[model samples]
Target: MKITCVGGGPAGLYFALLAKQRDPRRDIVVVERNRPDDTFGFGVVFSDATLDNLADADRPSYGAIRASLAHWDELHTHFGGRVLVSRGHGFSGLSRQRLLAILQDRARELGVVLRFEEEVSDPGEALATSDLVVAADGVNSRIRERLADRFEPRIDVRPNRFVWLGTTFPFDAFTFYFEESRHGLFRVHAYRYQPDRSTFIVECREDTFRRAGLDRAGEDETVAYFEELFADKLRGHRLLKNRSVWRSFPTVHNERWSAGNVVLLGDAAHTAHFSIGSGTKLALEDAIALVDCLGAHAGVPEALAAYEAERKPKVLALQRAAQVSLLWFENTERYMALHPLEFTFSLLTRSLRVTHEGLKARDPAFVREIDAHVASKAEAQSGVRVVSADAAPPPPMFTPFRLRSLVLENRVVVSPMCQYSAEDGRIDDWHLVHLGSRALGGAGLVITEMTDVSAAGRITPGCAGLYRQDHAAAWRRVVDFVHARSRARIGVQLAHAGRKGATKRMWEGMDRPLERGAWPLLSASAIPYLPESQVPRAMDRADMDQVTSDFVQAARRADEAGFDLIELHCAHGYLLSSFISPLTNRRTDEHGGPIENRMRYPLEVFDAVRAVWPADKPMSVRISATDWAPGGLTTDDLVALCGMLREHGADIIHVSAGQTDPSSKPEHGRLFQTPLSELVRLEAKVPTIAVGNIQSYADVNSIIAAGRADLCALARAHLYDPYWTRHAAAEQGFAMEWPDPYRSVERYTLRMR
Candidate 1:
C-alpha cells in the first residue's frame, strides 16, 4: 500500500520513516510546502524519551535525530531574586532548519521521497496516486479543514501572545524567565538552537499586550521590550533579534482526530501548549502509535480506526493536561501577586511527565527544604493540623498525614475516580477491586469519587451514594475489608450534582443526560452547565436546607461505615463547587456575588458535615482551585477562600483544577494543576493535594518532597497500574514488601521465568 504524508515537517517525515521502516516496500512519500532547509519555528525540542521511541521504531532515523540534537540537560528558571537551576530535563533542541535537513537526508537514505516547496490542497495532489493520505501539517491543514466535519475539531485561541524568534544571547541551555516590567508579567522561553544563537519565544497575556501597546510594536521594539523586562539576565550580549514575527498559535484539540482513509498527526492532530515542551514529542508519539496499529492490523480502514481509538484517548489526555497548564500560565496576574515561588515551581513541574515521587528522587534535599517552610506556618492557623515533614515520618512523602481524627499513612492519595459500574448508587465488585487495589497499592488514603449525598445529586446513575442506610452498608463492606487487610485509609468524597445531574454513564457518552427521562436538579441559580446540558431547577431556601441536611446525613452514614476521612466534593463543577465559582453561580440571594457570599452555601455544607463528622476524624475540601474560565475564581480568590476554610476547620485543601466550564481555556501539560495547588498550600499555608496528569512516581515524590503540595493525587496512572507505587519502587531500585498475604505471590512473580 502506498502512503502519502502531506506537510513534510517532523510528523510527516517521522511517520513516513516509521511506516516505510515497518514495511520496507510500503512506498511512503512526504510532501512539504517549504524548501528542505526552510521552516517556521526557530528551535524545536524533543525529550530523551522521544529518542527512545525513535530507537524502537527506526534505528537509522533515531541515529540521525541523535546526531543533530543539541543535548541540553540543564534548565534555568529566573524570576524575583530567585534563580532555580534544574537538571535531567533532556530537552534536545536545535534549529528547525537543521532538524529538517537531518530528516530530509535520512528520508532520502531510506528511499522515501521528500517533496519540498510543493503544496497540495486536501487529497487533490496525492489522492489518485496514493491509497492513504496522512495529514501531518503543522497547526493549520487544508486536508483537515476539508474534512473538519469528520474530525469535529476544536481550535482554542489561547489568551497569551507569543513570538517564535531567534536571539544571539548565548542562552547556553534551556531557560524560562518571568520578568516584571511596567507592562506586567513577560515570560520568555529561550534555549540554545546552535552553539551561539538561541531561540527566544516571548510570551505575555493579551491584557499586557494592549496595556503596553505591544500589538503595535515592530521587531526592534519587541526586542527592546524583552531586554528591558529581563534586564538582569539580558546583560552585555545585546539580545539580538531575528526576522520572525510575533503571533499566537491557537491550541487545537479535536473531539475527533481521524477519518476513513486519512488521519491527522502532530500539531494538526492536537496542539500542546508551548509551556510544556511536548509539541514535537506529541507528533512523534502520534507517528509511533500509527505505526504500531498498522503493524498490528492489515486493512487500511481497520488500522486507521484502531489507531484513532487508541491514539485519540492518549493524545486527548495530554491535550487536556496541556490545556490545564496553559490556563495556569495565562492567569499569571492572579498568582504572581500571591505565590510567586509556588507559581514558578508549578510551571517547572508542568513541563514534564514525571510523577510526584519521581521528582522527589531527582532532588530530595531541595524538596524536603520546601516542605519545611509549609510546616513553619502552623501557628498561622488555629485548629488545623500542622504537617511537619519530620513529625509525620522520616520517609517524607511516605509519612501519613492526619485530618481531624483520621490518619493517612502517606501523602499519596488515590484520587476519587468514577467506575461507572455501579447499579443505582450501589457499588459492585468492580468498585471494590478498583478502590481495594489502590489501597493495597500503597496510597496513604483512597477517596471514592463523588459519592452522591442524595439520589438527585448524582451526576450519573452509576455514581456511588451514601444517602441511604443500605448504600452506607454496601460501602462498609469495602471500607471494612480495606481496613482489615490494607494499610490504606479510606475517605469518601460526598457531593451533590446540582446542575450537572441526571447524566448518562461515563462509558456511554459522559456528559449527556439520560434520554428516557430526567431527574429534578437543584442549583444556586437556574443556570445550566452549558446550552446542551439540561437546565436545572433553581434551589429555594428550603431546597438549600435539604441539600445541606443531605450532606450532614451522608457524613453520619460515613462515620457508621468506619471511614477515616471525609472530603467534600466542592470542585469539578459539582453542586458545592457550582455555588462557589462565579462562572456558574448567578444568584441574587445570600449564596451569590462576592467571594464571602458565594462561599456561604459551600461553607454551610462544610459546617453541617463537620458537625456530624467525628471530631477525631479528619475532614477536607476538594476545590477546582481555578475555574479555567476567564474572570472566574482566581488563586487570589482561592487564598481568601482557603483562609475562610481554615477559620471554619478545613484540614487539607484538595486541589484539582478545571471542569469549570466546557468552553474554559485550559493550558494543560504534565502536573499543570499542581501550581495552583502549590500556591494555596504555600501562601495560604494549608496542607493541599496536587493533581492533574501526575503519572510517574518521581512526580509524586517531588511534590511531597518540594512541599509544593502535601499530597499528590493520581487518577489515570493508578488506573493503568493499580500497583504503580510498588512497581515504581522496584523501577527506582528500592525494595519494599507487599502485604504478607500477597508477599508469596509477588515473590513468585518476581522470580518467575
Candidate 2:
C-alpha cells in the first residue's frame, strides 16, 4: 500500500514511521510546510501515562524522547502572596523542536520518505495518487478546509487571549502564577522542558488584555509586560519570543473524521484547548491509534471507520474537560476573592476530571490541609467547633449549614425523589420507609418528593400532596418521626403539574397520558407537554389567582405539619417553570414577552407564599437555570430571576437545568448541572442547592469547599443507599452518630463494604 501524510508534524511523522515499521514493504511519504527544526511552540508536555503508549507503539522513538524528557511530580501554584505545592502528579516535558527531530529521524531510519519545507497547496493530488491520504495538518488545516463540505467542521473561538513564549528560567516543577494587575487578573502556565529553558504562556481576559495595553502592543512590548508582571517569580530571568502573538484559542471539531479515501488525524480532525496540555499528547496518540486500525483492517474505508469509532469518544471527553479548564482560567477574576488555599484547590479541580478524593490520592497531606482550612472557616461562621486543634478536621460535607432559622447538621441533602406509591395524594407506609430510612441514614436534610398543591396538579395518581387538611396529617406523621427519631431536617417541595399533568407513573411510562381519568391541565400557554399528550388551557387571571391560593394553602399546611423548611417547586416544566421558560410560556398579557414579564407569575406566587409562611422559616425556589433549547431560559436569566426571588424573601435557590421542553438537548456528565448552581451563587449573589448527578461525599465536600453551592442534593445516591451519609462518615473515620435502636447494626453495616 502507498500512503501520503500531509504536514510533517507529530501526527504525520509519527504515522509515517509506525506504518512503515509495521510493514517494511509499504511505501510512505510525508509532506511538510516547515523545516524539521522550525516549530511554533517552545515545548510539549505529557503525562507519564502517555509514555507507556509510546513504548508499546515504537520503543526506539520512545527511548530517544525519554532520554531528553524533563520529568516532575510536583505542581507549584503562586498566588495571593503565597506559594502552594501539591505533589504526586507525574508529568514529563520535552522541547517541541527536539520532539520533531526525534520523529523525523525515526521515520527516515524506517525507510519512510521525509519531505520538509514543501507546502501542499492542494491535498487532492495526493489523494488521487496514494491508496490512503492522511490529513495530518495542524489546527489551520487547508486539507480539512478544502473538504469542509464533507467534513462539517465546527470551530469555537474562545474569549480569553493568550500568547506562548519561552524563558531561560529553569523551573523544577509544573508551575502556574496568578497575579492581579491594575487592569485585571493575569495568569502564567510555565514548566521546565529542558535543563536551561521553560515554556512560558501568558493568559488573561480580553478586557484585561486591552486594559494592560498588550492588545495593540508589538511582540517585544508584550513579552516585556509579562516579564514585569510576573517578575517576582521569574527572579530577573528574561523572556524569549518567536512569532509570539496574542490570540484566542480556536477549538476545532469535525463531524466526520474520514471522507472517501482521505482521512484526518490530530489537529486536522479535532483540537482540545491547550490549557489541559493535551494537544501534543492527543496528536501522538492519534497517530498510534490510526496506524493500528489501518494494520487491522484491509479496506481504507473500514480502517478509517474503526479508527474514528474508537477515538472520537475519548477525544470528545478530553475536549469537554479542556473546555472546563479553559473557562476556569477565563473566569479567574471571579474565584480570586476566595481564601488562597481554597482558590488553589478550585484551580486544581476546575476541569471536573479531578475530584476531592482524586486529589487526596495524589497528595493526601495537601488535601488534609485544604480540609483544615475549610473546616476552620466553617467553624468560625457556624460558631460550633467539632474538632480540636490537634484533631483532623471534619470533611466539608460534614460541616454545618444554616438558612434562616434552619440549622442543618451537615451540608448533605436528600433530594426530593418521586415514589409512585401514594394513594389519592396522601402518604402511606412506602413514603414513611422511603423517607424515614434516609433520615435515619444520617442526612442533614431530607426533602419530600414533589408534593402537589392540589389533586389535579399531581403528575401521577401516586404522587404525594400537601393539598388537603387530612393530607397534612399524613405528612405530619412522617415529619414528626424524622424530627423525633433523628437530627435530620425535613422540607417539602410543593409543585403543580401544569401542562404535564395526568401522566402515568414513571415505571409505567414517563410523560404518557393516563388510560382513564386524565384531568384538565392549566399552563402559561395552551401548549401540550408532548406531541400526543393533552393540550392545556392557557391560564387566565382566574387560574393564576387559584394557583396562587393553592400555593398559599400548601405553605400553611406545611407550617402546620411542622416542616423545617419549604421549597417552592418552580422547576422541571411544572406550572411556575412553564411561566418562566420562553419555550413554554407565550402570552399577550403582562406575564409574557421579555424575561421580566415571563417571571411575573412565578414571583407573584412566591410573594403570596412568603406572606402566608412564618417570617423565621426559610423558603427556597427551585428553578431550571437553562431550558437547554434555543431561545429559552439560561444561567443569565437565572441571575435576574434569583434576584427577584431574593427580593420576595426566598432564602435559597435550588439550581437545576433542562426539562422545560421535551425537545431540549442537555449535555450530561458528572456534576453536569453544578456549573449552573455555581453561576447562580456567584453571579446572582444567592445561596443555592446544587442538584443533578451529584454522588459521593467527596463530591459534596468539593462543591461546598469550592463555594459552588451552599448545599448538595444527591438523588440516586440516597436511593441506592439509605445510609449514604453514615457510610461516608465511616469511610472518612468521622464519628457520626446513629440512632440508638439502629446503633447495634450500625457497626456491622458500616463494615459491610
Candidate 3:
C-alpha cells in the first residue's frame, strides 16, 4: 500500500512514523514545505494525560518527548499589582523545534521517506499515484483549499490580536501577566520550555493593538513594546522573534474530514485556539487515532470513517474549551472589576470543564478562603449572620437570594413542569399534589406549569388556566396549602399558546390536532404549527387587545391567588414568542418586519400586565434566547429584548432556548442553556433564571457562585425526584427544612444533623 502524507509538521511526521512501525512494508512518505530544522512558534504544552496516550501509542517517541519537557505544577497570575498563585495544575512544555526534530528522526529510523523544503503547490498532483492521501498540513493547507468545495471549511477569525514570541526569561511556572496600559489591557501568556528560554505570547484587543501603534510597527518594534509593558516579569530579558507577527486566531472547522482517498488530519481539519494549548496535543492524538483505526480496519475508507468518528467529538470538545478560554481573554475587561481572588478563580474555571468540587480538590484551603470571603460579604449585605470565621460557609446554592420584596431561602428553584391534568381550565388534585410535594421537598421557589391565560389559548384541553375566577379560586387552594405548609414561595407562569394551541395531550401525540374538538387559535401570523395542523388566525387589532386583556386578567387572578411571582411565558413558539421570532412572525403590518416593530405588541402586553400586577411582587419573562435556526432570534437579539423588558418592568429573565419552530435544531447537553443565561444576565445587566437540564447540585453551585445566573431551575429532575433539593442538602452536608410530618423519616435516614 502506498500512503502519501502532506505537511511535515508533528501530525504528518508522527503519523508516518507510526504507520511505518505498524507495518514496515507500508511504503509511506512525508512531504514538508519547510526545512527540517526550521519551525514556527516557540513551545508546545501538554497535559500528563496526553503524555500517557503518547506512551501507549509508542514508548520510544514518548520517552524522547518526556525527556525534553519542562514540567510545572503551578499557575501564577500577576494582576492588580499582586501575583496570585494556584497550585496543582500539572503541565509540561517542550520546544516546538525539538518536538519536530524528534518526530523526523523517528520517521527516518522507521524507513519512512521524508521530504523537506519541497512545497507541493498542488497536493493532488503530488499524491496522484498513492493509494491513500493524508492531508496533515497546517491551518493554511493547500490540499484543503484545492478541494475546498468537498471539504466545506468554515474559518472564524477571532476578534483579539496576538503575537507569539520567545524570551530568555526562565520562568519557573506557567505565568499570566495582566497589565493596564494607556492603550488598553494587555496580557501575556508565558511559560518556560527549556532551561534558558521561554515562550512569551502577548495578546490584546484589536483597539488596544491599534492604540499602542503595534499595528503599524514592525515585528521588532512590537516585541520592544510588549517587553517594556511586561518588563517587571521579564527582568531585563530580551525578546526574540521567529516570524512573530500579530495575527487574529483563525478557528478552522470542516463539515467533512475525508473525501474518497484523501483524509484530513490535525490543523487541516480543525484548529483550536492557542489559549488552551491543545493544538499540538490534538494533532498528535489525531495521528494516533488514524493509525489505530487503520490497524483495526482492513479497508481505507472504513478506517477513515472510523478515525473521524473516534476523533471528531474529542477534538470538538477541546475546541469548545479553547473557544471559552479565548472569549474570556477577549472580555477580560469585564471581569477586571471583580476582586483579585474572584478574578483569578473566574479565569481558572472559564472553560466550564473545571467545577467548584474539582477546584476544591486541587486546593482546599484556597476554596475555603473564597467561601469565607463570600460569607463575609453576604453577611454585610443582608445583615444575616452566616458562617462564623471558624467554620466554612455553605455552598452558594444554599445561600439566600433576594428579589424585590421576596427573599428566597436558597437558590434552588423547582422549574415549572407541565402536568396536563386540568379540566375546563380548572386545576385539580394532581396540581395540588405535584406542586405541593416540591414545596415540601425544600425548594426556595416553586413555579407552576404553563397555565394558559384563556381557554382558547390552551396548548391542550388538559392545560391549567387562570383566565376565570373559578380557575383562580382553584389555584388559590394549592397556593394557600403551599404557603401554609412550607417555606417555599410559589410562582405562576401565565401563557398564551398561540399557534401551538388546540392540540391533543402530550401523551397522545403532542401538538397533534384533537380528534373530537379543537378550538380556533390566534398568533402573530397565520402559520400552521405543523403541515397538517390548523392554521392560526393572524391576530388583528381586536385579537391583540383581547389577548392582552386575557394576560392582564390572568395576572390579576395570579395576584388574587397570592402568588409570589408571575413569569410571562413568551417562549417555545407560543403566542408572545411567535411575535419575537422572525421564523414564526411573517407579516407586513406595524406589528412585524423589523425587531422593534415585532417586539411592540409583546411590550404592550407586558406593560398591561405590569400595570395591574403588584409592584412588590417580582415579574419574570421566559424567552427563547435563540431559535436554533437561521433567520431566527439570536443571543444578541435576546439581549436587546431583555434590556427593553428590564426598562418596562421585568425583574428577572428566565433563559430558555429553541422550540420557536419545528425546524429548529437545538444543541442539547448538560446545562446547555446556562451559557445563554450568562450572556443575558451580563450583557443585559438583568438577573436571570437559567433553565433546561440543570439537574445536579454541583451545577447549581458553580453557576450561582460564578454569577452566571441568580437562580437555576430544574424541570425533569423534579419530576423524577420531588425531594431533589432535600437530597442535595444532604449531599452537601448543609441544613435544610423538611416537613414536620417527614421529620421522623429524615431522622431515620440521618439526613439532618
- lDDT values of the candidates? 0.78, 0.90, 0.88
The superposed Cα distance between candidate 3 and the true structure at residue 152, in angstroms, equals 2.6
Q: Which stretches of candidate 3 lie over 4 Å from their true place?
A: 125-127, 380-383, 586-590, 593-595, 634-636, 744-753
Q: Model 1 over residues 223-302: C-alpha lDDT tens digits?
A: 77777766667675556655656777688877677777788899888888877777888888888899899899988888
lDDT against true structure, model 2: 0.90
Model 2 Cα lDDT, one tens digit per residue, 578-602: 9999899989889998889999999
What TM-score fits each model? 0.70, 0.96, 0.94
Provide the lowest-lDDT 10-residue window in model 3.
744-753
Model 3 lDDT vs. the true structure? 0.88
Off by over 4 Å in 1: 1-4, 16-30, 55-64, 108-115, 121-125, 238-243, 255-260, 285-299, 306-310, 332-345, 360-393, 398-619, 622-651, 655-700, 706-708, 712-753
The C-alpha stretches of model 2 lying farther than 4 A from their native spots are 749-753
- Considering every candidate listed, which one attains the maximal lDDT? 2
